[model samples]
Target chain A: MFNFNFSGEFVAFFVFAVMIISGAVLMVSFAKVVHMVVSLAAVFIGVAGMFVLLEAEFLAFVQVLIYAGAVSILMIFGIMMTKHQEADAEQAKPLHETLTAIGALALFGILFYAIRQSDFPEPEQALAQGTDNTMEIGKLLFTQYVIPFELVSVLLTVAFIGAIVLAKKEAE
Target chain B: MLSSYLTMAAILFCIGLYGALVKRNAVIILLSIELMLNAVNLNLVAFSKYGVVPSLTGQMFTLFSIAVAAAEAAVGIAILIALFRARGTVNADEYDEMRR
Candidate 1:
């Protein structure tokens, strides 16, 4: 384990970076849907760790609770309900491979150029030192961002109804 | 040190992008998408620590991003299930019946 008090930030960053990369590789290379979902969970956990490093404990906790717990479980259920494990292996095709590659490369190039060319200002001073953001965020969510918060609730409700409708089987 | 972390995240993002684009399997694509999202999250947290934005904003955006990601995963998997039921396959390449 790497240990450096002044270098703690770098150490944490490096650890998170490794976790994310490995998880991504596992997710992409794994053939099984179940394995891919596991990798997705790993990646989400790594992200949560990064949030903790950034001093966002509440966000980190929510990331784990919502993504790793609920979303992943839902994905697994979808995979089981569909039962396409056998068919997935046999239906491979190579169409549009070249086009997609070119497009991805182009996108990467543009992003790299933008990041390289941009001048991001460093912090003049640490803003809001030693403040627990969870309370602040709660207040903002209820007071300042109440409308959007309510809208999100409505959206979630709609999504729930839509999911139920979509999953229901039609009677012959 | 921060540069190293950013490089690692960028590499992961690229690999995920390649997998998402080249792989025919819907499940693999979903995994790749997750990878991409994690890469963004890393960048957001990194910038929040080192750059000018208030830390709370980055954290808040990241929280919203996670919420959006969860919603997306649910809808994506549900759609995949529907696709499998109708077509008997989860390969992206075989989903060409709707192409004009």
Candidate 2:
């Protein structure tokens, strides 16, 4: 059933795809919070690989640093504080789980159908060439995307303060 | 090639959606949302590579989205901690204190 051109890049893409999909599935199905976090980290790493394949080295590095590094560790800390090993024993209602599965399946079917129907033209030579883009991305980030860049920094600061306020203990 | 990446992203989105809907734990919900965001990032990068007028636009958008997502996870986990402290549980179904 696998009738297609075989290349080194395609093989690598296949491996990364399997890694990402399996990691996501494990993240969903794992009973323990720690296991889920590990799976999520795996998925993040796989995504970074995909980003690299797409020729976005900066995004790939940032993906690993922020998602696999900061966000997942933050989640683990949350899990530690919330600390509910026995909570895994609790089961979701079967009917609800079934309904969600059906809904997700339906959505996937719709999206896949749409994706197949669309005809995407071959990309530009510059893009299809898949050149190293770290410098270009940085240049654009500081120039054309300056406003949004500054805004995101502000958002991160606000989020930091908000988290501190929300998680801080009340001074009695 | 474009279709394959889009398909992968769609599948990942569905898996994350199912988890977000089916899981009762708040932390799992947050993780599912992250998965969905990751899928979106994949789509953006794929489109940037294969779009009509490809440039750094999609990747730039993805950078912003990642920053925002990290912020969202931090704030969401902070809120979860606050709820866990106040209600003694992290169960989504049990977070009906507002109804009182």
Candidate 3:
């Protein structure tokens, strides 16, 4: 209701960014495992929103299907199957926390400075340009990018087999 | 516009990095890694939109990265389950068999 000179895109950006950042913070700081998982899903959904803003509707859908759907379910299953002792949530040492915070802040500062200082070229035309990117991405993925596409499939297969082998019950 | 997107990605990456480095839970660490990968995916898409060439290459790369991340998460969680079975714990600090 607090509408001003705010355009639609900025509103969308602000809403989605707040969702993402807050979810991420909750995911990191939550004490309960289940709460963390839920926050992670929220973050995934927020990421999909950002993808939509970028006009990558196909990627946004995939992000929802894979991350918010499958990956998150898998994570919850992992949490359920594993046992958590009372001591598991013990906080890290203050010194370690301080060091990591410094390191992360330093990295963020460097990235922010570099990105702000550099002159990235703007698209001559909007990338979406009212064309169906889903079809375009599909065609390119099956054509010039087919090799890596196939390789990713193979990688998925390997990971599948490895997970089965590792997670299966051992014979006594 | 591009800079703003990049800044958000950088912030997300740092948050994930901090969690991965300082958190004690193995599962939390894995989640942090996922967060970091998501940041990279966002960066790729942003570049795809804003780059001079503006081809579908970045989007395709993002697709591949998402697939790989899913597979990695599956395998990683599976390994974590196995680790829990063997050691009865999921704390990153406690998985210290190698140090012995």
DockQ of all models, two decimals each:
0.46, 0.71, 0.64
The 10-residue segment with the lowest total lDDT in model 2 chain A: A123-132
* Candidate 1 off by > 4 Å: A1-6, A86-110, A113-117, B1-9
Q: Estimate the overall C-alpha local distance difference test score of candidate 2.
A: 0.88
* True lDDT of residue A81, candidate 3: 91
Worst 10 residues of 3 chain A by lDDT: A1-10
lDDT of 3 by residue, A1-172 (tens): 1224477877898899999999999887788888888998999999999999888999999999999999889988888899875335565599989999999999999999998788887678776544787888878888898899889999999999999999998899
Clashes of each: 0, 0, 0
Candidate with top DockQ is: 2
Clash count for candidate 1 is: 0
Please report the candidate that would top TM-score against the real structure: 2
lDDT of 3: 0.88
**Recovered native contacts, candidate 2:** 0.80
Q: Return the DockQ of model 2.
A: 0.71
Better of 1 and 3 by DockQ: 3
Q: A1-172, model 2: which lDDT tens digit per residue?
A: 1235788778888999999999999988888878988998999999999998888889999999999999999998988899575547656588888898999999999998898787787765556333548878877878898999999999999999999999998788
| Every model's TM-score | 0.84, 0.95, 0.94
Taken over the whole model, the C-alpha lDDT of each candidate is: 0.71, 0.88, 0.88
